[model samples]
Target: MDFKNEKQGAFMVVVPAGRMDAVTAPEFEQECERLIQSGELKMVADMSALEYISSAGLRSILATAKKLKGQQGEIRFCGLEGMVEEVFSISGFSSMFPVFDTRDDAIKD
Candidate 1:
């Protein structure tokens, strides 16, 4: 996955393209960790270009969300489509986390 990091108001946006599977999940997780360490807990993952996500990817997101929750912040997902959105919904993550139609929507939250 190729990630483009951006700062929007109180949130840090990570726009990752391509597939976020086992191989790339760790890198994405590290990015989240970096944001957290930098005291940027409000995260918005702009997954508009992400084509796929496996169990490892879901785990990484869950871990990040948990971390943010502890810091009194959040991790919102946006621009999900196709199988990626399906997987998240089927896996019950839709209720576990907040999802938006655009990065701007997430940022506004």
Candidate 2:
């Protein structure tokens, strides 16, 4: 996966492109860690360009979400479609994290 970073007001957005599967999940995790370490805990993961995801990808996101929660921070995801949305729903994660249809919605949350 490729990640493009953007800053909008107080939020940091990470726009990821490509498949966020087992092979690329670590990169996502690393980016999250970097954000957290930098004290930019409010994160918006713009997944509009993402085409695929695996269990490992979900796990990585969950871990990052939990970590941010502990810091009293928030994380939101946006622009999921196709199998990516299915995986989140089937895993019961759709209700666990805040997801939005657009990056603007996610950032607003």
Candidate 3:
């Protein structure tokens, strides 16, 4: 997976592309850790370009979310579709996290 991070007001927008599996989950978690350590609390994960996600990927995201929550931070996800969306739904992550249909919507709050 490839992550592109951008600053938008008080939120950090993270755009991840490609497959997020065991091979890439650690990198994704590390990136989230870096953001938190750097004082980036509010984040929006724009998954529009993401093609696939595995259980490891979900675990990484859950870990990040828990860490962020402990710091009173938040993570929102947007633009999920296809197998990626299915994974989130089947994993119950769709209800666990804030999901939006668009990046713009995710950042609106």
Candidate 4:
């Protein structure tokens, strides 16, 4: 998996592409940690280019969410599709976090 991060208003928009599996999950988590450590609390995960995600990926996301929440921060997800969307739904992540159909919608609020 690859990540592209950018600041959008009050949120840090993280765009992840490719597959997020066991090997890449740790990297993803680390990147989020770095952002948080840098005082970036609000985050938006734009998964439009993500092709796949495994259970490990979900775990990483959950861990990041919990960490941010502990700091009174927030994380939202957007642009999920295909198997990625199915995985989130099946894993109950779709309800756990705020999900938007577009990056604009995710950042609007």
Off by over 4 Å in 1: none
Model 3 lDDT-worst window of ten: 1-10
- Displacement of residue 90 (Cα, Å) in model 1 is 0.4
> How well is each residue in 1-109 modelled by candidate 4, as lDDT tens digits?
6889989999999998898999998989999999999999999999988899999999999999999999999999999999999999999999999999999999986
Cα lDDT of all candidates, in order?
0.90, 0.88, 0.92, 0.94
Tens digits of per-residue lDDT, candidate 2, 9-75, equal: 7789998789988989999999999999999999988877889988899989999999999999989
Tens digit of per-residue lDDT, candidate 1, span 2-75: 88999999899988888889999998898899889999988899888899999999998988888889999888
Overlapping backbone residue pairs in candidate 1 total 0
C-alpha-based local distance difference test score of model 3: 0.92
What's the lDDT for residue 99 in model 3? 97
Q: With candidate 3 superimposed using the best TM-score fit, by how many Å does residue 4's alpha carbon deviate from the native?
A: 1.0
State residue 30's C-alpha deviation in candidate 1, in Å.
Answer: 0.4
Alpha carbon lDDT at 42, candidate 3: 99
lDDT of 3 at 3: 87
- Arrange candidates by lDDT, descending: 4, 3, 1, 2
Off by over 4 Å in 3: none
Can you list the residue pairs that collide in candidate 2?
A: none
Q: Give TM per candidate.
A: 0.95, 0.93, 0.96, 0.97
User: For each candidate, how many residue pairs have backbone atoms clashing (under 3 Å)?
Assistant: 0, 0, 0, 0
Could you tell me the lDDT of residue 14 within candidate 3? 88
How far residue 9's Cα lies from its native spot in candidate 2, in Å, is 2.1
